[model samples]
Target: MAKGKEVRLTIVLECTTCVRNGGNVNKASTGISRYITQKNRHNTPNRLELRKFCPYCYKHTIHGEIKK
Candidate 1:
């Protein structure tokens, strides 16, 4: 069985550009690109965001934390 809570947590980061441009019906989203990383729950309780490369966007964009 797992403990009540965990210190280090695994999270998913999704491209914000992909989400904002989701209305385009012609080009089907390659699906929002995601990056998996770990964070210390006690240190940073807020959602994390990072600039990362989005292949679909063809540029670096803000990737925000999303629920798994």
Candidate 2:
């Protein structure tokens, strides 16, 4: 982890079984998810990247920026 760059990320593993089985019943914070999805969809922030994860889902999702 980078100094002063460590962040809290919430992610989804895209597990269909989890979704169908109600494993993802709990609502996760979608802040990072929305940001990543937007950037990935538009292909913006080219080359700029950041690492994030969802502790609940145990997914290693990525983001463009880290929040304080």
Go through the candidates in order and give the C-alpha RMSD of each one to the true structure. 2.5, 11.2
Per-residue lDDT of candidate 2, residues 1-68 (tens digit): 67435343332223332334455434663222323322342334233454555444466544343332
Query: Candidates' lDDT values, in order?
Result: 0.84, 0.40
Poorly placed runs, candidate 2 (over 4 Å): 1-25, 28-47, 66-68
Instruction: Estimate the TM-score of every prediction.
Output: 0.82, 0.23
Q: Give every collision pair in model 1.
A: none
List model 1 lDDT by residue over 1-68, tens digit each: 47648899999998888888783422754667789999999999999999999877778989999999
Candidate 1 vs. truth: CA RMSD?
A: 2.5
Model 2: lDDT of residue 11: 27
In candidate 2, list every pair of residues with a backbone clash: none
